[model samples]
Target: MKLDLTDRQNQVLQCVIDAKQQKKRPYTKGVVSRMQEKGFQITERQCAYDLSVLARTKGTGIIGMRWGGGRTLWIYDEGCIQEGAA
Candidate 1:
């Protein structure tokens, strides 16, 4: 399922996907830090909001998230295609 995502949303998602592709540890934090380094001027809260929206629009089984303690984990369907990742 494809959802219409804003440019910034796409950018943030791309960051996540890219990290995953690189087999990087702590990909989630990498996404936030990389995006900030890219000068997106986004807060972690805003980025988390975007991910939540993406998870929703990504369809019921396409994405997932879990929050416990002070950390949140995001999941992506391995088979789902990300349109804007590098």
Candidate 2:
């Protein structure tokens, strides 16, 4: 599905998708680290904010599940088409 998001948000979503595809659990820490490794200069707080916005936005297909102790599991819904991806 098509989505309206900033470049960083898009990168965050893509990171989640990559994590899922790689069979690794996509947690906020991992996601932020991955983004940083990709040279995005993202922090955990920024990642969380981007995720919250994406979850609230329509057709983005991002879901965040809190797993106690303030930890969150990020999921990229496979039901929607990933923007800029084939």
Candidate 3:
């Protein structure tokens, strides 16, 4: 399904993308910290909120934390999925 992301959600998504690019890692905890380091005035909860949205919406190219169970869990970027699909 197509999904429209808010500005904040997009920012959060971009942050995750950049972080992954630099660290070669994708995960929730790092995303939360990265958001803060980048001066995004949001809490981990808020980050998780956007993540949940990205995860649920098919084709968004993001995979959010499912079950809220692991710090090692990550946000995935699917090169195969384009913005048009999202």
For candidate 1, write residues 1-86 as lDDT tens digits.
56578988888777766666776533356568979888888877788777777766643222545556555666555555454321
**Regions more than 4 Å wrong, model 2:** 80-86
TM-score, per-candidate, Cα-based: 0.69, 0.83, 0.71
Q: Tell me the number of clashing residue pairs for each predicted model.
A: 0, 1, 1
Q: Is candidate 1 or candidate 3 better by TM-score?
A: 3
Worst 10 residues of 2 by lDDT: 77-86
Off by over 4 Å in 1: 25-28, 59-62, 81-86
Which lDDT tens digits does candidate 2 get at residues 3-34? 77899999998898898889877888999999
Q: What is the C-alpha lDDT of each candidate?
A: 0.64, 0.82, 0.70
Q: Model 1 — TM-score against the truth?
A: 0.69
